[model samples]
Target: MLKPIKRAVHFDFHTMPGVDDFGENFDASLFARQMKDAHVEYINFFGRCNIGWSYYPTKVGYPYPGLNGKNILGDVVRECHKLGIQVTGYLNAGVHHEALLRHPEWSKVNMKGETVDLDPQKPFNGNFFRMPCYNTGYADHLLAEIRELLDLDVDGIFCDCMLLRPCLCPNCTKEMLARGMDLSDEKQVTDFAEEQRRKMIRRIRETVPEDKYLFINSLPCPLTKDVATHAELECLPTADGYDRFVSQVALARPLYDTVVYMNGRFQCCWADFGGYKGKAAIENDFYDAIMNGASTCLGDHLHPNGMPEADIYRDLKEIYAKIEAYEPWTDGTRFQPEIAVLSTVPKLNQSHYGVGRILGELNYAFDILMPDGDFSKYPVLILPDEITVSGELREKLNIYLKQGGKILSTGTSGLMPDGSGFALPQWDFAYKGKDPMQIAYYKPTFEEKDLIHLPWECYEPGILLDASEEDTVFARHITTYFNPGYDGTHFNFYMPPKGETGHVAAVMNRGKNVIQVSFPLFKAYMKTFTKAHRILMKHLLAELIPQKQILTEDLPITARATLTKGEDYTLLHVKATYPEIRGTMGVIEEHNVLPAGRTVAVKGEFSSACLLPDGTPLVIADCAGYTKITLPEITGYAMICLK
Candidate 1:
């Protein structure tokens, strides 16, 4: 098995030209010492930046003019090697400003037959302004740079910005035409672009040694898992918050042997030199990664002077000290999820984010899975929002269902690829077309009325379905009096619920193992955190899964709980820190503590129960095939072990 990256730092150095005094104040020994103090075991130093300038003296690429004759990359590599810290050479593969300026023919042309370049008005706004076409001579230039980094004796290569940007360059156009592909078709162009990227990855994988690590950023997991050594999820919470990170981690954990969660140290995002996320937020990010079965990597931009930031390392030292203490329990543990959510695509969508957030907030242990992922292990599988059941996947799911697997499918999940009808016979519903009323309301049945009393408004539309006579209806669809829209007369601002349409919104089969909801509840819940949606989901889960992994009482909705199993024990991780929305940014300034007297019940019996790291014993009892324990006051994070 490959060794997981526990503590690492990604040092970004995308410096522009005309910068003077580069590497003038660099002390190789001091830099290594600072990393050692911060407990960093691995580092990704800049080899070739987005500006197409190498930090080391190179023959294949232009050296940074500010470097003047200093081989900063080599010096840092030697120093970090002496301290047993592994180093990977970083290279910006897609965007090369200097190369594009020197060779205009290598630039990527878009569908409009126009050369893709940075906005002339805001050229310096982002680093990915001008991208080079891989089908051109730029591919050879990129490969030559990788060889140079290998010759420099770096431990590995970290290639960045390797996304699929469809190009219409002469070479790409010729190749597509030769393959009889229609350039006008968007899907064809996208597939061709993905093939080009896969070719580049294969070439890079061949260049790097099998033993050495090679990570390609922005490559979708399980699709490109064969070309890379491991997976790295780069998520800056300030920009998109923790939902994306959590969803990506859940998708990658089951596929890769080693997965690293990379988050920035900057308060806003990358390249914010004056910004810092402070100790509490950093702790929250790191612990969240660890509990989700991924190692942590902090993102920081190195100063042009080549010296480490003193204040950032100081804060890192304090935060990493706690991580080091908790490593014993988290080192080789595997996430124990009771439910598997089938992901519609390699890249996560709104449905993925919504389902992940709802499951996480509800303290239900679940993992995001691909269509081909194993389904037999999980007691219940969720097809969220937009998953179309393919023929091969339909066969696999049929076997799983025959073996007593429960499924909760929503919206267009169980539908056939052609939208004819549901592929699964267990659904027990006939698919009519989409509802004409885009927005409607949901009314629960009399039996489940206590869960949600009144009609809840659904902003998204649902598929029209007619349930079989044997099916049990949990909720009914209630159309709106009229969709809020301008009718060329007076505009309708208010929409009230009309009478029930006698059509089922949520239904279950006679076996009670398969439940299907007509609407896209997960996406709606993610867009609008409606309490009734979550309540309805919880009610559905009660019927699907009678015994949950972790049951909590008196716990705040903000708190998150995950279960993991180690060699000798089962660990229940609980995190209680909530991010405060401050002017468009979610900030965590302080850790909130939950008072004692909260109770938790873990499924299965254990010999003993105690708190992690400290080994403090907790009172435990057996209740209905579950081991119940009373949790002490927990601040920030807590791990309970049952062995």
Candidate 2:
């Protein structure tokens, strides 16, 4: 069963035993009332903290010494159950202070022959938490604690800090040797780490019931396919960058059915009394989460006295009220994607994230697809830089292309899976070796001629290919004078091109509509957010997939747009909020309002158009190939419905 966790809170209370009075002011009735007032439907309370202290009476693990035999978790769960608010028990998976004190051999050993509890170079301090190996006796203790937690009758269990790294501990080393795995090879180490993670997840699944929610935090990661039902992305915009929220959602949305963007109220993570962001910032974050088909969760830390912060709840009341109002259109709607971007490699793949960000910023509905995902629904497929074509994937692409599909590839995307050279008969291009120099310039001969920026830096220059006479040459490249080192910069900041004209930077086959670029455009844009690079990509996409595109008048690139369809109506979410750097972090400070004359092009036919939340009538017109609807005066976020 899917829990009603749309508007939720994550209470991270990693309190130490030195704090004597635990949950002294925890009035169960008052806490439940506060949560209800804040419009929270689900809450994740602590079962065990990182300090190895359990909140409830436990037979497998020691209880918090400061609890004085009181069951704080029991009280919270009992009251929340009465109020119809689901509770999820939270536990620290890896770190334990008490376990470190008892068994030193179980701790993780680094290359320096020292335990990872503290930096060996510094003096010994009592402030750091220790991580234990999962292949040792600590795994048994963890399973016992998980069994005790499940017996508490909570709705779910959220395990935190479950990381898998190469540990040099005695037990881990022995297990690696017994399994005949060599530690020197990085693939072997990574395989072992994944094995350990799978083992831990399997053990936890054996203990918890199948009906309950079991979330494991692996930081902006996808759900372990068969083991986890939902995926939670820890999207703290202040701690990390604000761009990560959208990029992470774009990556995880295609992998899991239930993806929650877990944001925190604090300015930073793990800060007990941290500063709160402005109200506009919080609302912007929630809107972004919902726009990408994800649930919303706010992170907070409970005080040592167990008293709910009155001001925090008051602020959340207003923000969550808006979310509740938008739930009708936000939930149970299918995202209508017209373009699919394929992921080539698993790691070190920057172009995948870069393409998603650019496409999202352009207000085009798209999804990031893995190699195995279905591409039949999408009319346009984008193969980003460095995607080598395997035999299996090559066959799939050939079939997709035969269905009159449009394709856009860059760099060495059409190369063989072995990374030796290009795979012929895949696309119309002859492999001529890579350019010796690093920096290059582009001059567009097709649309968007304003993208001609002189002396642009091409970090990872693509292997130059020969264009046929039947193909259309979109842009031509300009070779550089010298090769820039690994830093992607050269001593000559203003180096000129080798000549005014060079090889073709962009080309498109006449009949197939398959476009290829001579340089790594996505990687260059990722390195430097140049307008020229984006314009080049946008121009190519417009030529490839122009019939089905989102057309907005006078909308900035920061404004995001997504179109989704319900059973009877279609929702167009247009979010216009810009995050600027404030106090060493980027925060949404302004809720820019759009004028009444702004128009958005909708794809489907509808009888009527109206503003959401209130069915105020709006004028709609039938354009050449799209339905044009005039937008209202939107402040921060707006959802227009057409039926």
Candidate 3:
């Protein structure tokens, strides 16, 4: 029932083969051959969406002139159809095509009203735009071109780059005026793209019929992460932008949670613009992306007559095998709205933005989302710090709250973007320590202690308030600040934005039973409190998922449980940084397969997939959210049992 996109082959035109076009590295024959060789189920490729010129021979737009080649796209379509493969057309949503440069008026402009081409000579920079998504005449023109392209009888038309934000154009200004949002300030431009994004999705959906595939290469929205009638592709950058963007999409980006609100079948694509150069990197990326609930799509710059070298093809085949072997399954329940954050992006201080800590550590557990929207899908939206939010998302958040949702806004939240009246939360107290406290607490300890002082956040120290004001309260604690006197929003933990003092640590909502916390719940409160943070996280989890009585203690650090019908299995993977292990900073992740001390518990007999934890009796984990069994510190292994 989930029409998810699992595998896709991407093709880029090297150059137009016609006499009018200068480059001619690609042709129809080469593409068909490569796609067939790869054994791809789907195909995504970029075609020129220029004002008048066309990649294929079109009546309205001339093909690179003076050429008499069979329409390359036409041939590819024929070959692909013959081979039972699907073809989708790619377009630019933010910037104009090469021909649009001739009319500066149609170019993308920044806040200053100066129009500039993303590429004066070419349209595709692969990095998307520095501007926002909405407010461009190019979208209109792109629509015109798409209407023509759809006539080719392709299976679907993929509208790429439509969700790219941050463009300042004349039309954008006019559109903003129409929205009653007149602004001259420069910073307001950061989120101007999201509005247009909604427009772009709407236009594409309307233009395309109900049954036609209308793919919007979008991050998040009121949009569904899973359900796209038209397949979507993310043409992410290879190096810096790849993981961040892919994680955003796979984990359900923009503003929505993975759990409570995900729209089903939103196919995820991991872009590798470099093609063959960074194949291992590509493989690793796809693995992580899929693990986080997404499919894969690789990006390559188009050139005529050129294929992504032999190595690229070979690497693709290798990864293909890996993906196929996994036999991944998602049973409908995975599609729900859940909010996620990078715990990383913004640098509150000027120096930290580029040099901030990497988000790769928790990539498996959560999503690294963009700053344009408010995630309503999640029952609790946890902010590590203040982040860039758009006004559009603010409205969405208002809707979510009005419908009875809760948010755990922590650190220097509400300090970043989105001109909403929302204020950043403040912790009344600070907890002091000599060294950065190791975040450690087991499931057993959590079940016993039942509290956690989460770390990796900005905090302020003081007395607390028990009075339930307009909003109900859950939990709060005091902290002692060591490196005191650091002013101007200083966060004690590793952060892009530093909090000064009196930051919001953790709290829950009494009304909707919504709860939010800062960072990984074990850093501050429970870790240092009378109880451990693991205990606190269990409490939060219990509060969030009251329906499912998940046992907090006796579970692995990287434990994941999948329950279906009357059977269930808990996948337990040791964290790379688990086991405070006294002097050991963090464990090497690869050690999971080596078989450390592990105890197995389940509802049914242990299957052949597992080994006894040092010969402990394997039983069914029939505890709370099921059962909790003692297990080795593993990051990617599982405990299988039946309910």
Q: Which structure among the candidates has the greatest lDDT?
A: 1
Per-residue lDDT of candidate 1, residues 379-477 (tens digit): 999999888887788998889899999999998889998998889888778888788887888888745433648888876898887778988888888
Clashes in candidate 3: how many?
A: 117
On residues 343-447, what C-alpha lDDT tens digit does candidate 3 reach at each position? 434212211111111222211133344444445555544444344344555555556656655544433343335323233232222222112322211212122
Candidate 1: segments with Cα more than 4 A from true spot: 120-125, 446-452
TM-score of each candidate?
0.97, 0.93, 0.60
Residue range 489-608, candidate 2, lDDT tens digits: 545555677764447888887665588887767776777777877777888888887676568745777788888778998888889886787677786766878777788888767779
Select the stronger candidate by lDDT from 2 and 3: 2
Cα misplacement distance, residue 142 of candidate 1 (Å): 1.0
lDDT of 1 at 481: 74
Number of the top candidate by TM-score?
1
